[model samples]
Target: MFKIDKRYAKANNQKTIRFTDDLYMQLETIAKYEKISFNELVLQCCRYALENMEPLEKE
Candidate 1:
């Protein structure tokens, strides 16, 4: 099962990023349901993607 680590959820740094209005709404909804901050959810998504993605191949 997927779980958000409370320790990891604590922000240590900050960066600016932009999201489309639709995407922002979706993320906000999920974060509200999960009772976590929007920042935490986004961090989890980014970490998950980086950890599970395969490397790209060169032509």
Candidate 2:
């Protein structure tokens, strides 16, 4: 099950990413509703995606 934890450790690294305006608004809205920072939501999403991703078939 995918879950969001409110507590997070301080990040030691930083990254720059770009998002479409529509996607940005959607994420921002969700973060507000979830009472978490947009960054946290994005991090959780990325982590979940990686953990649950299907392995690619050998070509």
Candidate 3:
């Protein structure tokens, strides 16, 4: 019997996407070089962007 991990199951339920082979390879390379999973890399990027990205000021 195969029991799905809860975290994976939750992630699987989310609506999003399939990366192309080239992008996957690049993510893998970056992950390996940084000793982090590709998912972690993407999450870190998202967090950083959300924290630092500023919207335009309305005049």
Which candidate should be chosen as best, given lDDT against the real structure? Answer: 2
Per-candidate Cα lDDT values, in order, are: 0.85, 0.86, 0.60
Q: TM-scores of the models, in the given order?
A: 0.79, 0.81, 0.51
On TM-score, the candidate that comes out on top is 2
lDDT of 3 by residue, 1-59 (tens): 22212232122334466889998898689767777666666556555667677987899
Question: What TM-score does model 1 achieve against the real structure?
Answer: 0.79
Q: What are the clash counts of all predictions, listed in order? A: 0, 0, 0
Local accuracy of candidate 1 as per-residue lDDT tens digits, 1-59: 45675445778898999999999999999989888889988998888888878987899
* Worst 10 contiguous positions by lDDT, candidate 1: 1-10
Q: Which stretches of model 2 miss by more than 4 angstroms? A: 56-59
Candidates, ranked, TM-score:
2, 1, 3
Please give the ranking of all candidate structures by lDDT, highest first, separated by commas: 2, 1, 3
Q: Tell me how far the alpha carbon of residue 18 in candidate 1 is from the true structure, in angstroms, after superposition.
A: 0.4
- Which residue runs does candidate 1 get wrong by more than 4 Å? 1-3, 56-59
Give the CA lDDT, 0 to 100, for residue 17 in model 3.
Answer: 65
Checking candidate 2 for backbone clashes, the offending pairs are: none
Clashes of 3: 0
Q: Judged by TM-score relative to the true structure, which candidate is superior, 1 or 2?
A: 2
Better of 2 and 3 by lDDT: 2
